[model samples]
Target: MKADFLKYQAQTTPHPLAMEVSYAKGSYIYDINCKKYLDFVAGVSACSLGHQHPKVVNAIKNQLDKYLHVMVYGEYAQKPAVELSKLLASHLPAPLDTTYLTNSGTEAIDGAIKLAKRVTGRSEIIAANKAYHGNTIGALSIMGFEERKQAFRPLMPDVRFIEFNHELDINQITTKTAGVVLETIQGGAGFIEPQDNYLKKVKERCDNVGALLILDEIQPGIGRTGKLFGFENYNCVPHVVVTGKGLGGGMPIGAFTASYEHMITLSDEPKLGHITTFGGHPVIAAAALATLKEITESNLIQETLEKEQLIRKHLKHPLITEIRGKGLMLAAMTPSADITNQIVLQGQEAGLILFWLLYEPKAVRITPPLTISNEEILEGCDILMSVLNKIQPTN
Candidate 1:
């Protein structure tokens, strides 16, 4: 299987982790050799309820018994999709009642950008530097990091960038801007959270300029940040909210929400401006609904803070320079990129899952499942500490 994977699969990186998984259940993944590895990254923060959560699994099974994709999104009123959208609306703030489902987070980001332009009748988009919204062409155009996106030149035009958490950069948002898209908690950029009311200030600027504010909560939303949405923590309500990642538990989904007045515009002027073949597939929607219900109804959301504290307490070491971020969305920074790489590579052998932030080489991602137990948190931290100690320099 490994040989076939290498031969047939098109990979993004020269070398992938390439773990051969036999099965996964609740904060642990089992290799085909039957070795159990504690999952700290939670499939890169996509599996909200860990692996194969009971509620999500049962929901998918129930939905499967009924049907799969009935029709393109927004055409059919599927029960799972309708209930999921309604639940999301109830949880989110006003003017964010209507939802446009998509196949993945990047699609949702693209849709949100489109909605902003359609609503504002502007072409320019202001995005924060180091923000990782998604990988599609529209998303790639606004990506702040030039090294990763330079090769794909001539992307969508008129996309500008501003330094995140920098108050002075708010001036970049003007009336000509269609929207200002930002990660509620900047993911790939070392789990950086909004500080000094940065998001609120940006929203205010967008309002002053009549531009829309789009918050990309793909990594920090879905109860991972001690709240259903990361913007809530910062007291910033965006004109549009884009979410994905853990929204589907272990399944795949993404959605953008806005007011009915703004969302309905996409329907008439274009008479189907944006269409998806399986945006709200019944099975995936069922899993997402179940995941959202479980997270909101259970103590998982609040436990994220407790678990984050436990991780910080256990992961303290000379090699760990600082822990950035809040709740389950965290990044442990090391003194050097080599040390960070060593910890992640050696961690797999140590039976613990660890990952790296997209653009921050010295930052180790630690976004585990919200349902991860305190004991499990300590156990993973211990493994990380052990790895760091072995790699630490002796003066």
Candidate 2:
């Protein structure tokens, strides 16, 4: 299987963590050799309820028995999709009642950009530096990192970037701007949270210029961040909220929500302006609905903050320079990129799962499942501390 994976499958990076998984359960994955490894990354924050959650699995099974993809999104009113969207609307603030489901977070980002332009009739989109929306052409266009996107040049035009959390940069979001796309908490950029009312001020600027504010909550949404959404923690309500990642539990799904007035524009003028073949696939939607219900009904959302405190309290070490981010969405920074790499690589050998941020080499991502218990959090942190201690600098 490993040999076939290397030969048949296309590789994203030169070095990929090729762990042959036999099965996974709550907070743990077992390799083909039957070695149990503690999962701290939670499939990069996609497995909200951990692996093979009962509710999500049962929802998928029930939906499969009923139906699958009956039609393209927004064509047929599927129960799972309808209930999911309605539940999302109930939780979200005003003017964010309508949702358009997509296959992945990147698609939702693209859709949100289109909606912003359509609603405001403006072309320019202002994004924050070090922001990562997704990998699609439209999403790549708004990406702030140049090194990764330079090869995919000549992307969508009228996209500009500004330094995140920079007060002066708010001036750039003028009347000509259709929208300002930002990660509620910058994921790839070391989980940088908006500080000093930065997001609120940016929303205010967008309001002043009549430009829409689109918050990408792909990584920080779905109760991973104490609040249901990261923007809620900062008291910044965006014009459009883009969600994905843990929205579907262990399944795949994405969505963008806005006011009925703004979302309805996607229809009529273009009549299926943005169409998806399986955006709201019944099985995936069922899983998402189940995940949403579990998160909202259970104490998982509130416990995230308590779990985060436990992680911080146990993870204190000389090698760990600082911990960034809130709730379960966290990044443990090391003194050097070399140390970060060592910890992640050696962590797998130590029977614990760890990952790195996309752009921040010095930061080790620790975005575990929100349902991870205090004992699990301490266990993972102990493994991390052990790894860091063994690899401590001799200088």
Candidate 3:
């Protein structure tokens, strides 16, 4: 099967680890060889409750027995989707009552961008440098990294990028700007947090310019951060908040939420402005509902801080520069990309899983499942330390 993966499957990177998986439960992924590898990446922060979470799995199975896809989004009132949306509304602040669900984070991102353009009647978009929204054309258009996007030029015209956390650049957003899209915590940019009320200041600028703030909380949403959403930590409520990643627990789902007034605008003027065949999929909605319930009702949300502290206390090495990010979403920086690469590969060889951030060369991703236990954190950190100790830094 590994040979087949190399021979037949389309590869993303030139050299893929291509580990063959058997099944996963809790915070561990079992390879076909039955080796239980401690999963620190959590499917790149997508598995909220970890692999095969009982509640999430049961919700999916129960929903399968009831119904699946009934109709397109906003047309039918499926029980799972309706209940999920209502639950989300209850958790969100006013004006963020309504939600538009999608199959993936990028789809939700695309919808949010369109909604911003439609509601504001502006064409230009302002995004933060090193911001990563998604892979789709519309989502890709606002991506701040030029090298990755240069191959797909003429993406979306009038898309401008400003340095993130640069308070002086806030003025770049003007009335002509439809929306200023940003990652509440820049994921690909080394899990960089907004410094010293930067997000609040950005919100003020957007308000002054009549521009909407569209925050992409795909990575930091669903209690990955200590708060329910990363923006809650910043004390700024955006006009639109886009979420996915861990939203579905282990399933595929995404959603963009806003006030009833702001969200309802997409229904008319250009009637049926945004439509999708499988936006509010019932099974996926059930899984997301279960995921949300588990995160909110249990002590899991509060426990993230403790887990983060445990990992930080255990991860010690001379090669490590600094640890960045909050809760389970973190990145450990090394001296160079080559050293970072060796540590990740060697750690995996020693039975621990580590990954890299999208655009951060020297940062190793450490977004383990929120469900990971204290022992698992210590074990993973030990493996990382062992690998780091073996490497000799060049003078």
Candidate 4:
């Protein structure tokens, strides 16, 4: 199976973790040998309610009994999709009421870029240094890191890069700019949060210049942070918000929301301006609706802060420099990239599941499921600490 996996499956890396999964439940994944590994990464911050959560699974099953994708997005008034959109709008601020669903976050990002261009009639899209939106061509173009994107040159043109949390960079946004896209909390940049009202300042500048502000909430949104959306914690509301990851509760989904007045332009002037056939599949929408309802109705959102404090209290060690980010979205920084690689690999053998951030080689990604128990947190940390103890800190 391992050989077949390597030969048949195209991989993101030369060496993959390649865990042959028997099954997964709650906060643990069982290997083919029935070895249980405590989960700390939560499928890279996607499975908010944990593996095969009862509500999400039940929603999918129930929706399956009814129907599947009956029509392309926006052509049908599907119950699951309609309910999900309405609930999302109710929680969002005014003018961010309409949503367009897509297959994944990258697709939603591309859609957001197009929406900005349509609305502003401008082509310049700006993003942050070390920020990662997604991997689609349009998304790849705005990516701030040049090394990863150099091979894929001649991407969407007029995309500019700026420094995240740098107040002086806000001035780059001008009338020629269509959108200023940024992560609510910069995920790939070691979970960096907006500082000193930086996001608010950016929004104000965008308002001044008539450029739209688009917040990428793929990892930090969906109750992973203490709030339903990370922007709520930052004291700013963006003109456009792109969400995915945890929103699906383990299913695949992405959505971008904006004002009805702004979104309507996409449908009429261009007729099928941005269309996705399976964007709002019934089964996926059902699962997402259940995930959103559970997060909003329960204490899970607030408990994220408590859980975050619990993790911080327990996971300290000499090799650790600092823990960056809030709520369940955290990046525990080791002294060096070599140490991070060692910790990540040894962690699995120590009976814990860990991962790494994209651009930050020194960050040990520790975003666990929001539903993880206190006992589970201790269990994972103990394993992680044991691994940390095995390696000597190199100065």
lDDT of each: 0.92, 0.93, 0.91, 0.94
Q: Model 2 residue 98 lDDT?
A: 94
Clashes of each: 0, 0, 2, 0
Q: Give one digit per residue, the lDDT tens place, for model 4 in 1-395.
A: 88999999999899999999999999999999999998999999999999989999999999999999789899989999999999999999998999998889999999999999999999999999998989999999988889899998889999889999999999999999999999999999899989999999999999999999999999999998899999999999999999999999999999999999999989978799999999989999999999999999999999999999999999999978999999999999999998999999999988899999999999999999999999999988888889999987676
Residue pairs with backbone overlap in model 2 = none
Per-residue alpha-carbon lDDT of model 1 for 1-395, expressed as tens digits?
88888889998899999999999999999999999999999988999999989999999899889998878888878999999999999999997999988889999999999999999889999998888888999999888899999999989999999999999989988889999999998988888888999999999998999999999999998999899998989989999999998999988899999999999989978888888999999999999999999999999999999888988888889999999999999999988888888899999999999999999999999999988988888889888888988996533
Identify the runs in model 4 with alpha carbons over 4 angstroms from their true place: none
Model 4 lDDT, full chain set: 0.94
Ranked by lDDT, the better of candidates 1 and 2 is 2
Write one digit per residue (lDDT tens) for candidate 2, span 1-395: 98888889999998889999999999999999999999999999999999999999999998888887778788888999999999999999998999999999999999999999999999999998888999999999999999999998889999999999999989999989999999999999999989999999999999999999999999999999899999999989999999999999988899999999999999978899989999999999999999999999999999999998999899999988899999999999988888998999999999999999999999999988888888888888888888988996633
Candidate 1: what lDDT? 0.92
- Candidate 4 has a TM-score of 0.99
TM-score of 2: 0.99
Clashes of 3: 2
Clashing pairs in 4: none
Per-prediction TM-score:
0.99, 0.99, 0.98, 0.99
lDDT of 3 at 21: 97
Across 41-148, the per-residue lDDT of candidate 3 in tens digits comes to 999999989999999999999999998787888898898898999999999987789999999999999999999899899999999899999989988988888888
**Local lDDT at 364 for model 1:** 93
